[model samples]
Target: MRIETLGINHSAQEFLAEQNITKLYPPQADAVKAGLLEGQNILVAAPTASGKTLIAMLAMMEFLSTKQGKIVYLTPLRALASEKFSEFKKMEKLDFGRRIKAAISTGDFDSVDKESENADIVVLTNEKMDSLIRHGAEWVDKIGLVIADEVHLIGDKDRGPTLEVVLTKLKELPAKPQIVGLSATITNSNELAEWLGCKLVSSDWRPVPLAEGVFDGGTILWNNGDSDEIESSIRGPPIDLCLDTIKKGGQSLVFAETRTRSASLAAKGSDAVFKFLSDSEKKYLEEISQKILDNNEHTDLIKTLSSLLKKGVGFHHAGLNQNCREIVETEFRNGKIKLLASTPTLAAGVNLPARRVIISSIVRYDVKAGANKPISILEYKQLCGRAGRPQYDKFGEAIIVGNANSSDLTEYYINGTPEPIESQLADDKALRIHILSHIVSNPGIKGEEILGFFQKTLAGLQIRKNTLSFSIEIAKKFLLRENLIVQKAERFAATEFGKKVSMLYIDPITAIYFKRGLEAVSENNAHTFGFLHLVSSCEEFFPKFSLRNKDYETLSTLIENKSSELIEPISEYDCNRSLLALHSWISESSEIHLSDNLGIESGDMHRMVETADWLVYCLYELAKLAERADLLEELSTLRKRISYGIKQELVELVQIRGIGRVRARKLYDHGIRTVSDLQQIPVNKLAEIDKIGPTIADNIKSQLKKVR
Candidate 1:
């Protein structure tokens, strides 16, 4: 179907032409015929590399043609939100005959982000949209179109409930915004579309079809009944298939179960990949390899990744910092990296297609189950969707290396259909957080109205009514017991504490826990380590640390020595690992030292520091609410220390511009501990300090003068 035949506005047609997109894919044509341009809600469940993004853009362009109201785009991950934001920003160049604006909000969950209210389009993560509603973003009523990318996450355990509740809330908005849900192929599309009042346009079609098969040591048993001989290598099965792809002038994306395996296998495959790289390609990769190591914080992961990049392979995971990950992604996209070894997190992210896909393992570590299990068919589909490069390949190959489980892998993952997506909102922990949020946002909301709101949720529709009712009751009891909500005259309202907790986007339980810790810290005049220990207790923000067998004795003795300073005073061995690791961090320990002593790398340490900064701010806000302002001064300093990973003395020095943890440490070692010290010290002497040159010394002098 042609864009012109869809009867979209002239500007949308011209926009499509500029991108050389005249004809629509069959799935996109189905969407157009289903009234996508006429403002009907739609759920597009198609394979990856289909025209889903184009379908979404057409809907948005049609709505923007009227200039009646703004568009809201929601994604599940920050990476996707950024990708969509960058993609939508190009709409400004369209011949809309008027200016178009797009903005993104992903973090800092407390503020209202008034800057984005005027944007014609706002791209956000699911949690950010929920946060905006809680804080009452003024543009809620102005939203005319809401596009949810990765809509299948409504079935995710950690994230599904939030997406479910947010979608329900948006459906009830005054504007009646048209909702466009973009998803991977799932079995429950009809059910989900029914819940959303959407036209379900679901298909398994793709621009580049997949050839899925199982690769034993001897041959690949293709689904089409054709077998291809594979020469096994000591380099491993994944690298073997990857080399096969490279020989065909294509790239390969390999999914491993863990970060360690991702790196290890990438290294195992690097030599084979290196052998295939032309000299020019090797030279192009050498520059990227240097860039990977250039001006970045040295971590064990980065060093290993940089070494692999030079050999035409890369490893990707959450443990690598943003710069390294972006470098890996860009190189792979540019076709410089021949093989990418990654975890499943990348499967659900922005499109990064290769000529072939390989699954090194069909089993993964289920953290909750405490064991390894077979991968779901839906997961296999998601990963296999990355097999082919659209417009570049006629067909993509997805191979699973099955030695003993070859028949089971072929039957279960290749032939089996995806399980229906179910609700995780029936859990008590999920309900309590959102229940307080709904009540706080709509205070004095009656019990029936509140449960009625829950009734509108997907959980309310799919799960048993009686079970959901019981869960809601338990949630309400928890809120009341935790003093997050108060009841009067058959109505419910959030307490000031509850309001703060909800607006800060924290679990009510964490707020209650922090409240007790704040009171104890204020009462006892506890030191800085106490607050670090307290925030470290919340595993949602600061991740849990794994304790080594040798450390139990050391931590036990330290607990004995610092018992008066530790706020919680729970001497359990498992509880203090995060505190101990983070303590080693803020003490100005080197990355290698932290990795050796605490088993935390630079990327993980930095992530913890960033989360600690926010958690510290939360503690500061709650302290004001608790009237424990006495702890405010110390916490203010502690927040800065957490951010820069510095000690108390360098906290003052780090406040100066152009000085980070390293510079401030050098100054502190050189007897310049504060801005006043910089003012009093000679610029020449300050320049003599290690790593601080004359230019920085002069800049510090001028900054002090400005302060004066």
Candidate 2:
């Protein structure tokens, strides 16, 4: 079906046709024909850059026209949300007289206040939408349709719960608006479709036919039932099978196991490719160099990238920072640079399509163990899906670069499919808090009355026995015995306390813990006790910080230096566990001894750190909800000392803006520890403490006389 035939009009069709998108890809054509134009929910499974985005936009536009509400295109990443914002702008311009005002809600805290209110068709990350709905934004009622891009990410433990809740909340909406789920053909499309109440349009067909192949001994072996293998090695070297595909007028993407290796490969390939570019091309490279130096920070890696750009090549990874990654991706896509070596993060829904995709190492570094280990099959498929952009190239290539065991490569890459999508419902903290919020916010009577609600959740799926009894047990803890839940005339109802807990949107247990941490931190003895709490938090519950380059010996020395000041003595075991967690958080994995015969793994450290970081963020927010602002500020300061960045400075600025404890403390620390201390600081030095100019210093000095 043409874009015009679906009640979308010729102008929209012609806009696409003018860009040479005359015919839709199978997934796009199928979605449009499957009554998506009639406001039906759609689940489209197609490869990346295969015009699935266009399919979503068409559906969004149809919903906007037929309904009196806004359309939300939600993505998993801020970067992806930004990308969709740009794509939607083009559609907005081509919408004839029906102007759709679109905006992105990703950057800046102020974006939440401004864009979300008036957007006719807004694009936002899933987290932002999750927060919005939970807070009961007035604009939630204005939303008529939600397009969940990369719906497969619902399996992510950290983010999956939010998506699941958002979907569940949407189902509870009065209108029951249409839902569009888009993905790259995961293993269980039917199950996902059934869950969302949508039609599954699963197709292996691409507008551009993709020919699968394996390069064995410098020969390209096509999987098109050809008994004969084609001979070629022009791509570079058949050392990695993808090199053969590169020689055949196709670009290949090699997924490195580590950020360090990605940069190393890019660096190695740069010198080889410099000879290919002309003098003018080299000058175009210099232009990029100047642009990088102008816009981004002057880091050693940035400087190194500037030099590499001169040779018409570059690498990408998270370590390079956002600005550098964006530059590398933009340049690579424009064909200014060829062959990007990147980590699996680059595979997370970035629209960089390559003719051939190579898995240089399926095994990524295990930060806990301090070594490399094999990745899950789900990750492998996500990376390989980057190949085969529909309507552009005839065939896409995916190859695994491995050891002498060539047969093993085929099994891992070809035979492997995406793993089962698991629910994060088993998460204790997430479940307790969200459920409490639901009970509190809505007018509910009894604990047993809402047991059915728990059963609707993924967590409820795992209730092997006595579901009601288990829920009532958990609900009692959150609602409290005398708090708000009451058995009235055989029905349960939320008391005033239960209502407050729902609005707080925190687990009752965590809320109690937050209070404990706050109370412990706010006392006169807090200065010493705070550090102990922070350390213990890091060790057991909070995301652990890894200080790379600090060995066991080095940490032991540091701990010794602070031993007298610390509330409790630091031990070797504590030092090792803390260090391991920290390294994993920063993606710097190393091995450590656990027992005589067994050692703790590397990557596990980082995973633990990630878990800690997320929990900390949650707790900090919970503290604020509990009205423990002072404790929250104190903990935030500690968190900042561990993770340094400009954002931390901005946070400090906000914290100490006016008549606040932080401002008073800074004054006190500067011999202006109190209101009186503000009278004593040498005005010149005050200018150095960000946002406090000389004039403000003079004003502060004048206000000092009012001190009690």
Best by lDDT: 1
Q: Candidate 1 lDDT, tens digit per residue, 1-708?
A: 987888777877887898899999989999988999888999999999898999889999989886589899999988888998888998877666678888999989989786688789999999999999999988888888999888888889998989998999999998899999999899999999999999999988889989999998668999988999877788877888888888889999999998889898899988878988989989989998888778575667777888899999998887777878888899999999989999988998867899999998988998789899988888899999999999788999999989877788899999999888998888877899999999999999998888898989888889888888888888998899888999998899999999999998988888888888876774646567677777887745666665678778877877787777777666656455677777777788887777767777666777888788889899999999988867888889888878888888888888788999999988888777778888998889888889888999999898888888
Clashes of each: 0, 32
Quote model 2's TM-score.
0.76
What TM-score do all the candidates reach, one by one?
0.96, 0.76
Segments of candidate 1 deviating more than 4 angstroms: 95-97, 522-524, 680-708
- Tell me each candidate's RMSD, in Å, in order: 2.0, 7.4
Window of ten residues with lowest summed lDDT in model 2: 588-597
Return the clash pairs for model 1, or none.
none
What lDDT score is found at residue 237 in candidate 2? 34
Q: Distance (Å) between predicted and true CA of 342, model 1?
A: 1.0
Score residue 56 of candidate 1 by CA lDDT. Answer: 88
